[model samples]
Target: MKRRPRRSVPALLTALVLLAGCVLVTVVTVQLILGERPWISYDAVAATLHDLHWTDLLPAVAGGVLALLGLVLLLAAVLPGAATVLPLDGLFDSGAARGGYRSTLRAAAAGVDGVSAARVKLRTRRVKVRVETSRTQPDGLTDAVRAAVTDRLDRIGPATRPAVAVRVRAPRRTS
Candidate 1:
């Protein structure tokens, strides 16, 4: 079973459109039943519809716009969003949040002797580790941080272990 995050924006918009249409229909129905003039003028709408021709540029442009909007809504509903969690290598369905992995890897990189600060970015197939250090000649700091992060990933045991890329940045001199 593949785990993927789904967006609610499209669904919410569709629901709101349907709700507005229903409310408008209900109000018109109630007004007609009470023998009162509806907010929308039926005569004007009928005249407008009667005047509009299928070959007219306005009607063609309106139809094209509506078709494009419908296509966009359909695509949004069908496509899957980004994954919030990474699946683990287990028999049962299990996963770990990306934030947890990032924090854990950050701690692991920061625990190294020369690393002063560490920032980890967890991507689909790569883990980027950027470390900041005060030492002028931070020679082996990048390797140390990379090993630490790799060890942490091994401990976490994700289904597909992402490649660890480490970058070390020296503290800037504020002269």
Candidate 2:
């Protein structure tokens, strides 16, 4: 299915933070220039900031956490947004097809011997496949599923090849 990516959400969040920062800076600048006591008393804020001591574990930790959050926000703002959907080679039109490959991976895993059913979760950098079977011998089922999934992924040719992990569940009762 074709769907638009939500890259703007983070950008919007970053913009809101920047806007808030600009408002703060403008208020502070105005306060300094015009000598006005406004919404938040700058004097009290300055006193609290200057009095922050290393010995005060709570405040120190809080400051550190806030700094870390700011750093994360900065990185997110600078970094390119993640690709939401994996693009596939188009059959009829260029850039018309996109896939997460969940069904393809699941089918590939289920095709392996002793894999009665399979569940696949495909992500940008990782593919997780889980298989269930009633067969007693599951010695090589894991390796088999892994190989099948890897082969299928190679054929699909995603921009970044994801690591494949295969998990086999216990055999079900034959009743």
Candidate 3:
């Protein structure tokens, strides 16, 4: 079965950060021009801002808010189908798993007879797996890597073979 790529939660979060920044900028500019303080006294806000010399706070505030929002997005990434949270942890997990599987396959490729180098990418039913090699990859290298990954994943935990993709790499010193 063809697997659908997970949505980019970080991208969404970044958009939100931009939105919040716009809101913040508008709020500050409006407050400065209109002499209205929604959260505190206008005179007090004016006095504190003027005396504290905290004009640089705009970026700080924006950064702080973005950081908090990032944390929330990360949490959502961990938990699937989070209404308020985006599943970003899963993305990292998929990447790590794919990397691990690729490395293992590469080692297997090295051991395979007539194989110069191996690049493997594996995607399990759980996440993403992709591996690429620039070294001399001989014929049947793809099959060899696939067999290796299947065997390893089977030994370790439950995973799907179809989700994993083993791409044959180009041979080094191509004429």
Structural similarity to truth (TM-score) of each candidate: 0.78, 0.50, 0.36
Candidate 3 on 45-77: residue-level lDDT in tens? Answer: 678667654458775797789799778878666
In candidate 2, what are the lDDT values of residues 1-175, reduced to their tens digit? 2344655766788789899999988987887789776667778989987888778887878989989988887776676554555655535322222344677778889999788899987655788888998877688889989999999977877655789988899665566
Candidate order, lDDT descending? 1, 2, 3
- Candidate number that wins on lDDT, 1 or 2: 1
Could you give candidate 1's per-residue lDDT for residues 51-133 as a string of tens digits?
A: 99999999999999989989989888788765787788878888888678789999999999988998988777899999999
lDDT per model vs. reference: 0.87, 0.76, 0.55
lDDT of 1 at 153: 84
* Candidate with best TM-score: 1
Cα displacement (angstroms), candidate 3, residue 157, comes to: 5.7
Q: Give the runs in model 1 whose Cα sits over 4 Å from its true position.
A: 53-61, 113-117, 132-138, 169-175
The CA-based lDDT of model 1 is what? 0.87
Q: What is the lDDT of residue 23 in candidate 3?
A: 90
lDDT at 143 for candidate 3? 73
lDDT of 1 at 105: 90
What TM value does model 2 have? 0.50
Each prediction's total of clashing residue pairs, residues at least 3 apart in sequence or on different chains, is: 0, 0, 10
Q: What is the Cα-based lDDT of residue 7 in candidate 1?
A: 54
Which 10-residue window of candidate 1 scores lowest in summed lDDT? 1-10
